[model samples]
Target: MLIALLLAVATVPAGQMFACTPIRVWDGDGPVWCREGPRIRLGGIAAREIDGSCRRGQPCPRASGIAARDALVRLLGGARGRSGTGHILVTGPRLQCRSTGNAKGDRTGAWCSAPRIGDLSCAMIATGTVLRWQRYAAGHCR
Candidate 1:
């Protein structure tokens, strides 16, 4: 019964808590993958706008965003730790994001670290792939 109770009260839905693995990723300030639901976009802090570019030339989009996403994949992959795990934990902000229809629809999500690897956002920022976007909240990335 303990296991049943735990599952019932889980902060995240049981299927997501245990099954929201990163089969794919994208370049959001923080990216969310698809599973059986919409997650990270609903709960994670936006790391950087993939649409924004660092420089403005003829069609010049800042390469930084792509770099950031690549870094995110690398970081997440490195920390994927075990099967069906490594959800990134975005604990700083709990604000609502704009309702944009990304390749996947918008939804709520949970953030966690790759097993024994550490936080994905912090790692990406530290490595210079991402920077703090200060338009959303008043905290770390504020």
Candidate 2:
């Protein structure tokens, strides 16, 4: 019994170690979406609410998808001029969105759950002509 208990205790910490980091949608324009494993992040229709409803009569902006992709690439520390892809270590879902006012008006947005320590695709809504992003480290659970 003593040997069994000791072996179990030794394995606990190793089991807790995560292989993948949680990546959550921070913010973006259009219909923002993401996928894990061969990660593909895309921006969809521009919406005014959390449910992703495209505003009526609002034409898709030429720079919308570019803006979203730019935000993700910057967070991952990828090259500005190159369009290649690579893996990024994202640990949590703590994200925020800020927007620059365009000729029309200021945009608004939000995200769902906080990221967990696992593989996931994150997506969110964003407003403004310009979008900014920042990365945060995640804490271990007790």
TM-score per prediction, in order, is: 0.47, 0.24
Model 2: per-residue lDDT, tens digit, 1-142? 5334423331212112111122433323322212221112121224222233334655333344445444543443333242133223333343222111121211112222223312111323232322222221122110
Encode model 1's per-residue lDDT on 36-138: one tens digit a residue. 2334542223444455554232222234665666666665553333233433322221121222233233443443445534544445556665554443222
Residue 115's lDDT within candidate 1 is 50
Task: Name the runs in model 2 displaced over 4 angstroms.
Answer: 1-37, 41-62, 78-124, 127-142
Model 1 RMSD in Å is 9.5
Distance (Å) between predicted and true CA of 92, model 1? Answer: 22
Model 1 quality (TM-score): 0.47
Root-mean-square deviation (CA) per prediction: 9.5, 15.2
Question: By TM-score, who's the top model here?
Answer: 1
Global lDDT scores for all candidate models: 0.42, 0.28
Q: Give the TM-score of candidate 2.
A: 0.24
Candidate 1 local Cα displacement, residue 17, angstroms: 6.4
